[model samples]
Target: MDKQKAQIWIARVLVTAVFAINVQCAIQFIAWPESYTYAYQLSGASAEAVVRGYGICFLMWNATYPPVIAAPHRYRVLFIVVIAQQLIGLVGESLLLASLGQAAGLGTLAASITRFIIFDGAGAVLLVIAFALTMRAARSLKEPAE
Candidate 1:
């Protein structure tokens, strides 16, 4: 297969994995909101508000990913947007843990946070590579070998 095709397939596969994970999270939030709230150590009122809003937001944002995966070239801008969101998520999660983890005693949530960091971090890295390859592939078409 060609480099571009390989890159596209790689990105799609990685993105599908991320999508699947998000689906699970959304389902958990929807199907067991109270359980999720307790698992995340959130209070009743706040958990109710957060789970409802954030869960829907998560579903909505994730719903945009399939189009990008289906046609990366057509959705190049969205690819960048996805990359940015992943970075923000990773950094924001780490910052939250760093700033409040100690104070809040987040050790009990190590496994939970670790899974998020791993998946988000991996997804970000894959998308970055895919973007670079896509750019290179596009440029190669415009500038032939010297």
Candidate 2:
């Protein structure tokens, strides 16, 4: 009803959409049949390794969602948590792809790098900026209106 509440709701909806998209991507990539070896190979990752990494990614993603829409104060902590999760995801994804590249070939490595950078990189930047905006809005909510 209030401006702060609206902002919190907007942030939550945006974050939820991002998480849902991630879940879809994970399902598409991680749940693919092992027979589709090229997908994993291109990412320079083993089928098993990508699956395991995705499990961790999903867990962290779910962990960062805020429990309620009305708590702007609580959302600040949620923003930090989400940012931390994104950092972890960036590192884990890069390492996984790099390792896969090493196991496969340079071409596979390039594909892996490209996929992560284009998709995950964009997603991470968007999520980080959204979280920053959420933090800013939350802080402003606590300040007395002039």
- Top candidate when judged by TM-score against the true structure: 1
**TM-scores vs. true structure, each candidate:** 0.77, 0.64
Compose the digit string of candidate 2's lDDT tens values, residues 89-130.
678777766666555445755675567656666667766666
How does model 2 fare in lDDT?
Answer: 0.61
lDDT for each residue of candidate 1 in 1-146, tens digit (9 for 90 to 100): 88866766776777777778877887777766777665456778778677767677778868767876776655777878878888988897777666655555566565556667887898788778777765665565443221
**Candidate 1: misplaced stretches above 4 Å?**
43-49, 104-106, 109-111, 140-146
Instruction: Please state the error at residue 37 of candidate 2 in Å.
Output: 3.4
Kindly report which residue pairs in candidate 1 clash with one another. Answer: none
For candidate 2, list the clashing residue pairs, or say none: 44-100, 44-101
In model 1, the Cα lDDT at residue 107 comes to: 60
lDDT (0 to 1) per candidate: 0.71, 0.61
